[model samples]
Target: MSPHAPVLLNEVLEALAPQAGDVIIDATFGAGGYTRAILKTGATVIALDRDPTVQPHADAVANDYPQTFRLIRTPFSGLAEAFAQSGEAKLDGVVFDIGVSSMQLDQAERGFSFMRDGPLDMRMSDEGVTAADIVNAWDHGPMAHIFKLYGDERQSGRVATAILRRRVERPFERTLDLAEVVEKALGGRRGAPIHPATRVFQALRIAVNDELGELRAGLEAAEATLAPGGRLAVVTFHSLEDRIVKAFLTERTGNAPGGSRHAPTAVETRKPSFTLTFKGAREAGEAETVGNPRARSAKLRAAVRTDAAPWGRIAA
Candidate 1:
């Protein structure tokens, strides 16, 4: 298995500014790359991952640095409740590394890659419905909609129709089967660098795992869990996820629509919940991108929580 290297590591650590004795949350904890780095600063790390496979990694750290790290097998979207239950009312810093890890994509058994042929099982957490389940069982209209909205694929209707037609003959059971269907529907491109099946696979993975919904929930959880002066750093791998992160940060920092005098609200009730650490998104440097090709599309954004009321508490 290829070791999972945390993308834009220097940028994330600098933005988060982990200090000694600080309590930080590693919201993704794929291979404990960020978690391990945070521990070097003598900070206590509360790491969470939806996949149960991360438990052993957390255990390894606990053995070496007892009481410095705690791993919870749950999605980062539930972070606030998880922290509250653990009696950590707030955190000094929080980091979210979004999207599929190199570990998941490189491992053929996990079935997250279009390049590899394996079972059509793309659930981040094994407990959730598999990709095969969605492709084989979901209504045709919803399937097309997911492809259009989530994948942003132009030929969603044709792709969905083809998938449904083939599944009737034999339920989609493997990654190659679905990839072949998508390739046929889209008409294989000879010279294009990106696979024709890429968008379809992404759409299925997003729908099966509810990635966008979980991201919104995770951002809300981060907002509520961050202490005054706390920092939140998020790394997103695609435009769709980056857009959601950008909007969430903008709203929290009071840069939303109606900031001017002509706005509808009579009184602005709350101060800004956060201040932008970096005005706009930051991308991986050329060196980092060259080292890890996946870092090419990664974007990092960060902000520091401001002391404010009403708006400070994230709404359900």
Candidate 2:
């Protein structure tokens, strides 16, 4: 295995517990790390990724696991369709390592990282709205909202204001240009551990990709596709992604409160389509975090499918 293994590899494998002949899906097949690891266990792996740049890595894995592995060039939200195309009635397991991958962040041309000087194009796939589109074209209110809601940036309004002020002179085209404007707006990092533009950039990427919506759809698709007793494991790198996973599992496992304080009498109970494999989310250990900084924010959540019918759109 490569030294730069996927985050929480052992834990995800343990949760899936793949055996020979088992069929699995690597929903976010970045660099084919998870898919390759699963295939080595003698299981058939179907990997999905929307990013065209991942094709080379997928090809390398395909050659290595010709009989047991395949790649589908679509977002994970389309995993159910991919499975349907596979003609596999029972999906034994599905694993997702969500959020931007290390490969995407490392490439300067990909324009995912604020640290790298590149075009302000953060589209995970070839098509769709780019980061430049969001930053340069979106109005101030929507832009500030995403900065606050997606990135959790405290000075979202201020940052958006700064971008609006600069774009009038010349449209923002490069990562450094936007980063510089954001940094200046936020008072230049203020001796912070992270760059001042980090949050704003994160907000832009998430908005450009509609990451939260995709995650919700993907989780629902996984629920509808997995066979009874099948397993699902998700690894998230930030709170926004982790929260969605946590909430989905909580509701699906029939563990969430039926009604809110204001709607105490309007309770709606549904059969649980899955059961939690663990009580709460799992974090990387001290040793793993030391070796991989990306693992620091990583959280693993696993569940087992039940015989109950999927709740579908009713599940939050």
As a TM-score, model 2 comes out at 0.96
Residue 126, candidate 2: C-alpha displacement in angstroms: 0.6
- Pairs clashing within candidate 2: none
Q: What is the C-alpha RMSD of each candidate to the true structure, in Å?
A: 2.1, 2.1
Highest TM-score: give the candidate number: 2
Kindly report which residue stretches of model 1 are placed more than 4 angstroms away from their true locations once superposed: 259-263, 266-268, 310-316
Q: Candidate 1's C-alpha lDDT?
A: 0.86
Cα shift from native, residue 172, model 2 (Å)? 0.6
- Cα RMSD (Å) between model 1 and the true structure? 2.1
Output the TM-score of candidate 1. 0.95
Error of 2 at 249 (Å): 0.8
The TM-scores, one per candidate, come to 0.95, 0.96
The per-model lDDT (C-alpha) reads 0.86, 0.89
